[model samples]
Target: MSPGPGAGSAPASLTATDKVSTFSSFRVRNYRIHFFGNAISNIGTWMQRIAQDWLVHELTGSAAAVGITLALQFLPMLLFGLYGGVLADRVDKRKLLIGTQAALGLTGLTLAALTFTDVVNVYHVYVLAFLVGLVTVVDNPARQTFVSDMVGPRLLRNAVSLNSANFQSARLIGPAVAGVMIAAVGGAWAFLANGLSFIAPIIGLLMMRTSELNPAERVPRGRGQLRDGLRYVGGRPDLLWMIVLVGFIGTFGYNFAIWLVAFTDQVFASGPGTFGLLNSLMAGGSVVGALLAARRGSNRTRFTVGAAAVFSSLLVVASAAPNFVVFAVLMPLIGLAGMTFQVTANSTIQISSDPAMRGRVISLFMMVFVGGTPIGGPLVGWLSDEFGARVGLISGGLVCLAAAVGVALILARIGGLRLRISLRAGSRGLALVPRDPEEVTAPAGAAIRPVA
Candidate 1:
């Protein structure tokens, strides 16, 4: 018989001590190197994100221009995401990542040079954004699936949570620094800084011990592998439902850069510092949410649905704030709920996939999650431009709310779950529990098994 997945590598089962340590993944030397490297690179990525949007706005003074840039940036994913995943399955992930990282860094430097030379224009922004998206199409899936290789099956969830923490922690710093650079010196420095940050990951990947990784089964040269990936997802109700919910929410509800910039300019009448500060606040909340997911050690489809519902509702609340302070207060709350939804949904999809098809599966997941931005980003940008930020915010939130509700209802029927409510001692609680007693518990983080 063929060796099982993760054979000759770390097992999925955890030791008692492993369970106690929330940062179990950190114990792995490879992952520790990757974690720090990713943290530095991610900070640079965040800075570029802020500077890019700001640059677009500065050039055109049109929110719609920012939206168009956002739309263009993700268009390559919609076009080539699945193909990238196919390559990831067939190619050496580490080498592919090194190439993509180098390309991305060069792209950053190209934009920085144009800006610093004072010749950057709206067309330049559009072209460069599209180019970056092309690189991201390959990089996103490879980077995502590579986590399993570094930590094996044992600390996959913990590692995923820690990755989010590292990314968000960077967000906590990157935007603030970007804002200061934009305000005090200039936006060109932010772009230049991001270009250099890619060095950290390049060094990390070079230093890693290749003998230690748990390599996934490579797909043989064959036809119909793409169809195989589609069929794999099509057959799973849990994965299907989760993807549908996130598709709606992510497309409409997560246009933060566009809206936050609008809010800063129109509502607050403030500068880049306020805009960056708000993003940093949301990142702070994301860091908190990520740490909570790590410590709680829970991963279920229900958490994905429940968090989406709460997060969308909070977005609606955020839209109605009377001033920047009230709006700022709501950002952290939104960030918490958003991170809960994102991290849990990500884990659900990754854990549910077969090892052989993990890269293709993750690519599909990201295509829907981020690729839909092209459709939503421009439209939402248009809405904000014409109707103002409050209306745009409310509309996006309501659509997200509707999507979450739809998922819960569909899952309840398929899983034979029932809603239960209790009011005692002046306390109230609500639950969606399996109708069968045996369904109350299972392996930790098991996807809720839907009845056929």
Candidate 2:
């Protein structure tokens, strides 16, 4: 059975004093190669993302059109993400990744060719986006588990944090470059660069010495594997509740593409350059959040929940910003809190899960986190079109805020924890205090049995 949070056997070796270095994961040769190669590819991916959104908007001149594009890109994940995880557990991740990555590159090249030929329409973009999503269904879980393959459990958290940092750092470059490139030539060039960029990672994967890697034990082909994964998650409150919170937040609160484009054209009267600037600002904050997560000693569930609340609050505040400058300034805080919550949740789940079940577990985590985009994108897009951009943003933030508080109460109740208030000045007043241990052992209808 998969372990719950704070019950994983692998983390027992490290004590408070044995705090890991922020860059300790770099000591692994294979991880280093994987990091740099992914760095280049992530930048390319971000560029394509920005260009694609802008291209769709430019072609259709409607925020709802962009929403449709986003929905199409993520639809496959909602449909086939679990099967991809099962495949990851059964196959060699390294070889599977090569095939997926090549396929993704081909999609990029196809889009670029169509764009350059002057025959590309919104339909072509929709089809290519869908194809990329299909590749991502398998690629996402395999790539996530591959970190464990490279660095083992001890460095897994650090590597994951660094991976976020790397991707955010690329965001800093990709959007700025893409904005300028699209302005200078067109979106086609950005697509071309992203297509060519895949060569770097493919080369890196080929160069790795397979002997030194610590691959997980592959699960044999069998029936009922998907059901097994669902049961494992259902039995663990920590995993299930965290997934629930992220799902709510991801669905409603994370529809930035629609809001950003609407605000840029309608609210700020700006263009792609301003959009790129806004994205870069948020990416900068994400980098900081990632590094902070890497430097931390542990991933506490409370900390993750707190970050979610803070992120939601910031979104509400950003929605009401008086001017472009104010909204722009607030993006970093939103990004920071969001990234901190994401990194903590991801590492916590991975560290807590059984190695054999890690792929399926992470797949479920991602399925809820990202697979909700299809449902959310169009809804938010229509809200922006009918009501306004600010209204859409505020509505999402309110939903997320409510989810955070509700989940906190449920967790505390299940764990026999109570909120304690102190009237004394200069004290840590409010806290969740534990009740009698026996009371929590099998709380009425509680599914959270602590892992001993």
Candidate 3:
């Protein structure tokens, strides 16, 4: 039976193979609904982002205000992201998501109402931002792990990349739309639109056929679960290094909101219009990067570290661009590199963690990845205030570059991974050969199978 040419050519196999080649996650019916709906919501999310930043800038001519708002939004994550992950491990993720999304919409409406009534102040923005952050502390981890339920492990990499693509694809449009909308109407309209966009995700969630979901085993109520989650991640050096590298970049490198404001106000002397356009340009590049990553196979640690180094270098170069046009043109390239690094880091961590521990691990990863914002945002803001926008950006980039170099050296020494030339046919470049324990006494050329 297995000898026939057509034996393995079932329609399901053909479909799955086709899916793996391009935006493969879309093959799942539930994921397709979630994807499109989430994309719509993300567009609104970006619009709110631009609107909030610009509104704060207009209210107070301080870059720090914008930073403070961002800080408050993420501060909740800083405080609760781990616990949120713990909670995610023990709950129905979809039901939890419904509640968080609804709450977030209310937060947006609160801001919108305040704005429309002409009483929207910086403090008001800060309050609503905190509220939004509270919802996100729960939402981020659940959403991160929920992808696993939707598509299963085999397509997780493609699904993660597509999720980012969905986000960045909206990013490509959102800022541009926000800029025009803010100029035409006011930031309130953008906030209102964001509030309404929540409906789509809610609808998507409700419509999902629950029986198709591959739910993970939930952790029962227990005393030492948090410690167990931490211990689980603490045991994996690869996960540790990935988290640390990304933590550094997230803290220092991803302070675009601060830097973009500084450039618009101080360096370029532009308005909200230009600022929004700059964001759009950056996101357009990110869309390209995410799509390219979607086309990639397994998420490799080597690729992750290398991408970070390149991303850091690009940031350093971008910091020195001579003029606004040059800076604007350079943004897309920087976005491409940054997205590549982030997508790799994200997919790598998600795919590598154990299913039982995935929620908690992703929560920890998200905590570091985004929770660093409270420290980094205000610090980068102050740096922008004290020195200059260009210097602030350069400083962030340099820190990232140094982190990349340091991590690479440390991991190479610890893993016994040395660079070697492979003269085998068509594989002539330098490659990392992980020395296997069985072949510990052998030279590089007498390679046993490279360690996983």
- lDDT winner: 2
- Full-model lDDT, candidate 2: 0.86
Candidate 2 residue runs with Cα over 4 Å from true position: 1-19, 436-452
Give one clash count per candidate, in the order shown: 0, 0, 0
Q: Write model 2 residue lDDT over 143-178, tens digit each, in one string.
A: 999888887787788989999999999999999899
lDDT (C-alpha) at residue 331 in model 3: 90
| Stretches of model 3 off by over 4 angstroms after superposition | 1-19, 419-452
User: Once model 1 is optimally superposed onto the true structure by TM-score, how far is the C-alpha of residue 62 displaced, in angstroms?
Assistant: 1.3
Model 3, residue 157: distance off in Å is: 0.6
Using all chains and alpha carbons, the TM-scores for the candidates as numbered come to 0.93, 0.94, 0.91
Model 1, residue 434: distance off in Å is 4.3
Q: What is the C-alpha local distance difference test score of each model?
A: 0.85, 0.86, 0.84
Model 3: per-residue Cα lDDT over 79-159, one tens digit each:
888899899988989999999999988988888999999998899999889988889989999998988888777777788
**Model 1 agreement with the true structure over 219-274: per-residue lDDT tens digits:** 77789888888877777778878888878987898899889988988778888899
